[model samples]
Target: MLEHNDEIRRVKISVRPLVEYVYSSGDIESGFRSVAALHEGTRIHQQVQRMYQEGDLKEVTLKTEMLYADILYQIEGRCDGLILLEDGWMVDEIKSTSSDICFMEEGYPVHWAQAQIYAYIVAKEQGLSQMKIQLTYIQVVSGEVKKFVKSVTFSELESFVWGILASYNPFASLRLDHIRRRDDSIRSMPFPFDSYREGQRKLAGAVYQTVKEGQKLFVKAPTGIGKTVSTLFPSVKAIGEGLLQQLFYLTARTTTRTAAEHALGMMQSKGLHLQAVTLTAKEKICFQEKVSCKKEDCPFADGYYDRINVGIMDMLSNETLMDRTVIEHYARKHQLCPFEFSLDAAYAADAVICDYNYVFDPRVSLKRLFEERKKKTVLLVDEAHNLVDRGREIFSATLGKAEFLELQRGYKGKNNRIHETSRVVNQYFITLKKECGEIKRKLWKELPEELINKLDLFVQEAEQELQGIGHGDAESRQLLLNTYFAAQHMIRISKLYDERYVTYAEVVRNGVSIRMFCMDPSFLLAQAGKGFRSTIFFSATLSPLQYYRDMLGAGEDDYSLSVASPFHREQLDVRIEPLSTRYRDRESTKGSLVRLLSKMVRERQGNYLIFFPSYQYLQDVYDHFSAENSDLATIVQGTGMTEEEREAFLASFRSDNPDTLVGFAVLGGIFSEGIDLQGDRLNGVAVVGVGLPQLGMERDLMKDYFNHIGKNGYDYAYVYPGMNKVQQAGGRLIRSEHDTGILMLVDDRFLQRQYQELLPEEWKE
Candidate 1:
């Protein structure tokens, strides 16, 4: 037994975390986790466990304490199984692999280290001096097993434990020092701003209390409340109080991530010594033209793990603000992959600023996060209104027929197994398309298990070929890899298929595309956020709290808050044009909308934005408005604008501009909510419609699916979401107490009872 003391900290670590840190080294593989391989691994583990004798114990929990220098390292984990031998016991660790087992000579040293550690614990517990540890590798596709055994004396195991501790101590000590300083700085830190807005402290206090109590919070504070700072400050304070270990500042837009970074900077100015890292998308930050992670393809990925620790130590020691530029600099200097380096630093960071995908997307989430770690973490979701649709899109999966058909042709004579699997999957879609007849579309309430079965089999066969791929078949290899990803995703999602999901198949010009559309992502969202200490969902537009609460999976005990606007309602001059901007009425209303936009700008010579529901509407309105009012200078938001273009669009709304600038952009677009244009920079905003999503198969499917349950399908699928965007677009008008602007609601639907009730209290007033 080891005693706990203040002078020496106790590092309660696990064997897996220790070995994974010191041993696991490889190139950054660009692929999704194989669902088939994961399931097969579990099955193989069970098969091995079943073969254990009566005296053998499976999943034996093990723990041991050792003193290194002055720090007590307490490591605990469960071994796969413990087998009783005639003279000594053998510690067995089972593994499954897609690649051929014959290629593995003695297997990975990491596997031996893992089994050796478990053997040490069992020997220490039984007071034995000798132990035998075994590594069992079961080939996933072939079911062939390979075994390697090693005998070790107790002194050798003890030496091994000390060696492991020596390697981990530097990182552990650095973290210990940082936490001490971080807690001290947080304790003495004052609010970064000279004074808080009227509702700011209230929101901050609510966030702290929610995190302390380990409960989710849904907050609706009006714009200009300094929401980012308000939420982040409390979460940081919670970290200092030992109520939380990590904070994930999740954002829906790149612009909002900047807001979070700015907030952290402000806090740092107030003597906060916390480590925060911002994760940029791989495509945007990668130095290479294409995102190939092969060591040969990219120099940064070569020997990455060998240099990552040094790079992380240097980065954490010197910088508190590890944004993209800073991260990239260190990565380049140390020859480490920037994207992987950022993720590595994030695990050690006190806070991480990244897209919601890093935390919520099943396809791209950081899988290394365990439940124990999550229990000590809090999620501060920024611009949370965008997450509803984002959540749905993240959970859905689509597979096209063309990819499989091409695979069938590409591997016809090359590999019979691959060719046959591709043919079978392609034939299913062909029959599916014909079954739909003239409609050319079909919907199924349940997942087609028959299709899932074929995909599972195909995935198992595809993995075998993809293991030792060559450049000669680059085109075919890429196609198979892409198709494998698609199949695995569908197979994974099929397990979660419920009433909230619908399988839809549509015949397109190229081929048939099938999608497992997630209608309401609330359940999935809830599951993703389950083990976290707390999740603070704060936004300027979380109106009709009941609707959002239901859609976001808020529980009965989960807190809800609606903070009144600190700015006076009188500052916002709201008006209802009562004009039809519906799809059917858009042709006749186009001239009216353009005229209204022109007249609204002509009234006051300041910057203004007119938001339409779609890009086409914005273009049509812009063409007519520009042709009729040549004197008015206007900028139109184009589809797929580059980063510089987006910045230019926002820059066009300058406070120093002497003339009127009417900017036309789509509702729920890049500029609507995230951009900040304080004071006279932005004068007014006109929302063209209720912001209903265009009627489509997905939307209609969602409506029907929700209706089948006990909820109002139309409101869930359309009205509530549309109204939320309307509020987000309108939120641009009033940004500060000193700011005053006009908000014109162009559509007559705004006057309807359903839409009227959904508007925020301040907006309605």
Candidate 2:
């Protein structure tokens, strides 16, 4: 399917990536990752810019393109600042560093390359004979500033630009060739599926239009509608039409990520030759048992940068569906770090299948991804309802007193810096604990800047200790790594702290811990997608669309669609059993719930799933059910089931499954939602209780916070979210029109008008 054309297409690449690919050279090693560990000087940049005179521009945008042997290279970028000089104009390149200014005396070759390209572009456009290029390095730790200037004639700038282009041209030409072939296949490839079934066509159409219009769309296309392909196919078609350059199918769970990979594989088999790369988590994807990045520990990590480019080129040239296995194959082949290799391959990929955190998380989101690419990229957020809670978790940060106390004790006398910094942080918690002795819990409307400042000092020391990690044992390095990430996370979260965030500290019997909790993740979630071309938030049950719209920060102009269930309501035999399943009544009603579940499964002999609000409640009911109905084959969901165990569990359900199995699963857990069991494999689903979350401080805080903002606090904090889990569990049944099943709503609250209003159109009584 991947065939070369006689002529190559123009590949649009910005200056950052261009210079990085051409001029940068090093082994693939992580730098001191802590944002505060270095003097990034975001504040200093603005402060320095203020000193510039009028007519001098800060953040100047520049563009230039050149054609080389059959390849058109489009290069554009924004310079940090452009100053007006008496002779002409000066290209100001600002860089923040943590090291001493003396090391920066000659300036980095990459920095010079970047500045020279800007100089060349400006000189060529303004018809100038010469230009002054200045490199300003701001030391983040000391706030010390160093400036270097170089004067070059137009001919000198042109020669330097040409030399870099010669190095970059091969990579560009390779990509250009691939794009031409990829576009041809995309333009000619027919719909992979024989046809769209049910409301699949409608879902696909809405997604295509949304991407074309450059807007966000919230789609409520239920399960069994082929949601993955329905969204992917149209987006792939858009790429062929030259409306898009890349697509990111962001998923929340591994099951859904696999589903995306399978969808792309299906298309590829049908003649689609697009490069779709899947990013597995670093910890899981690592080839080593432990992630020790030292050269002595890992061969793949040692010379990663030395081999990564060749690995990327080889992998991209051959593979279309670059899933974890494919990525690992090439990673091992080239002796490159598998995780970092996947990230590099991802930037070059036409489509990326990765987790939501890669795009939205504040601490770990890909930093090198520029806004220009985002302008041509579309985000397909699969199982979007999960993003609400997941977003809350991603944006939240908690620090326990025990971690710092442990570090203080462990590092004492050995590393004075780590010990002193840890002791200071530990002392801060000790003082705060006395103030809250009576309640043991305190809340703050503002972020604790003093604590953050202390953590910043701690991170600085932690990074230093970690640089000598190989000198210590694995445990020591692991401890240092954990604390470093924690401190860095706290710093990152502090920067994003606004009115939507609340800081809380609670002292338990064991230890004291403080948290910066995101009461509403809407603003931060919206902020994460600041530059993306468009986003499509789709799931089988995005019920109460308004709640999702409000919480996901959907604009008024954004599109929303509610596709009718393709299957007839007749296929689902719905029942509303009025019984008390609230936490208060769960104890007394446990036996009755077991009997009801037994009765429902006894009436029909096929696979069934019974969902409860909590695992303890589920276990209690499961214990009673097993006592009474031991004859039926049964499986109970466990806590944190591994990938193999989960697959074997799902594999237990099949069309040829001999027994009428009754699987007891907790609501909102893995099996309760994402997994599918179509046709005779699944016969019924009984969702016990109203699915309200356990009453906790965090939930209460969210409730009170929402109430203060004139919204329905209880519903926002508990009811709707709980019911979303209930609906997802129920949705597992009646996946296809041919599949007939019974759906029983076991909670008395379900019959209430307020709760009934939240039910799906087909499920409501």
Candidate 3:
């Protein structure tokens, strides 16, 4: 909700969330929800609306403001129909559900409350003495309808709405009070740091200007220039100035999340009273060893809605920075799902620290952000370079024949519809496999419409089967649910397919796999980022600023700012070994690479990190380095390392270490970006390659597509992405002005004009 006035403190909210919050109850339904689009319900609504007589109005807008507890709430909503009765007008609210209409009986109380609220607004606005309210429920599939009607005087409607507002008063009061305090603090707060570093004020000014003008800003700020605080400080000030309501600090890695949190905490220590929530991934935060949201298996998920409001109120009232630890603590105290609890709290927060998926990914995005709220919210995307690949991943979808084949076999006698649909989908894949016999790969510019239709039927049947399955049949239910989600993703992506998408089929021994690969996600990214007040994309390695701006969907009028490194050239000892670390030359050059790494570590009696393009290369070189040194302290980053392991790896590079320590990690792995090891903590960084991604069909397809579009095909496909990893890896060194570290680039390609031009000015002689 946005505060519309300064003298009286007016809060604006729509009717749906306002009523649902007060009426929402029952267990958390974390099962397979029907993925039917909302537009289906709208179509049904229009179908019902078309049946009304001539004088009745459809989709009528109603709004009213009520004074409660010294705060004015502007409530507004669109009634489905306003029918002219013989005596007066009746507010008709239409709802569509997938369930049987026969079970609706008198209809839900929330539905009645919503209709009555609209009636209250209408009656109050038009000076009507009384109004009739109707709740109309229709079955989505069968088109069966049920209607429940009630007549209430204006006084009764007024009393009911007052009660609703009373129930919502506690939450509203907290928000109003917090906003007052947060704004006051922001007005009086000084910079968290004693002084801004070089280029910090310039970046911060650019961010503030962008938010002020409601435009996007792309920033190429260096690592040590305090990008996190620089961006966040201005957004916070914007919230205070009433230019924005909230901001989302979006990042791709856990370490960057920590940086944002730290920045917020620094401000909080300086008297800021903003409420910020950090959303953690469900799999990581789930209390269960295995994430099963069934009520019988997880107490935290049972009756979650009943407890969630109270829990959120308590948490928000007491805590300001509700990160994972604080959220988990409150969740346990209230026996609520931590993931859902965090999301609930996030909706009311002044700042949300979360992943890019929450705003960009269609499947998992926070759908509750209404259009009005978005016009006042800003997105500060940290490590914006990572969104290029992350965008590709979120927009793409893949389905294999194995799951459908298993379903066809397993559910043969259990459910014939599931079996038949799965069989049809499986047959489609089999035919595709036969067509790609020798080539083993097939590509198409158009979507696989035939396969998509089959998958849709399969998904519908799987959803019904899942809903009907007993709790004891968890195994079969799990399989059906998994395949249902896959099919849902495929169907969803199919709707987004355009000239930028490519449908590809691959055949292997066991089965055939098909993918709807998103070749250019810029358009989709722009669509997702629309409606927000502004977006700030900042990173240390957003080199080739034009490329990032283009790939990130920057508008022609959007501003781009590049800040110079705060650290001097003398602080970085950069050396190029001019060695070939390409795929084919690895074996022949392994010994030389090992010798160079050993010599660097031997000369520098401090902590060092050597980054390779792949784990295979890391392991191979580590084998030789270990055999040759035999006395060095080394820690190698493993595949899928746990949180504790990653923390321990960073903790190993102690400032007071007795001997030299070297950590071998992959270039784009967790160790590459967002980790800070200042001064003696990290003395040197050795990058073994130019960080080109392995050659593959996807790369080739991307190359061919970009070439066809007249861009530099090779650079767009491989060099840009690869060099980004190298830059991120090298950025780990010289984190602050006081830090001076050696950086070695072992790839021969670094001397080339194309690659040398990509290097940061401070990294070159």
Cα error, candidate 3, residue 657 (Å)? 1.5
Error of 1 at 524 (Å): 1.3
* TM-score of model 3 (CA atoms): 0.97
Candidates 1 and 2 compared: the better one by lDDT is 1
lDDT of each: 0.87, 0.85, 0.90
Name the lDDT of candidate 2. 0.85
> Runs in model 3 with CA error above 4 Å?
2-6, 37-39, 469-472
For residues 1-765, what per-residue lDDT tens digits would candidate 3 score against the true structure? 746346787778899999999998988775667765443677888899989998999998888999997889999998899999888899999987766556556878888889999999989988999999888887665678889988999999999999999999888988888888889999898889999999999998999999999999999988889999999999999999989999999999999999999999999999899999999999999998989888888999989989999999899889999999999999999999999899999999999999999999988899999999999999999999999999999999999999888888888887888889999999999999988879898888998999988887787666556656433256767888888888898898888999889988998776799999998899899999999999999999897998888789999999999899988899889999988998899999999999999999898699999999999989999999999999999999999999999999999999999999999999899999989998899999999999988999888888888888888889988999999999999999998889988899998899999999999988888
Q: Tens-digit lDDT track for model 2 on 1-765?
A: 112356644656677777788754565544346464333567767768888999999988898878777666677888989999998899988887655675556788788889999999999999999999999887666677899999999999999888877876677767777888888889888878898888888889999999999999999887788999999999999998878889999998898898899999898888888999999998899998987676767888776766767888898878889988899999989888888888898888999999999999866687787877788899999999999999999999999888888888887778888889999999999988886779998888998999999998888677657754433456765777787888888888888899889998989996898999999999999999989999999987787998899889899999999888888888999998898987778889888888888899989778899988888988888888999998999998899888898898888888787778998898999987778789988999999988889999889999999999999999999998998998899999987779999999998888789999888888864
Clashing pairs in 1: none
C-alpha TM-scores of all predictions: 0.98, 0.93, 0.97
lDDT score of residue 293 within candidate 2: 72
Report how far residue 149 has shifted in candidate 3, in Å.
Answer: 3.2
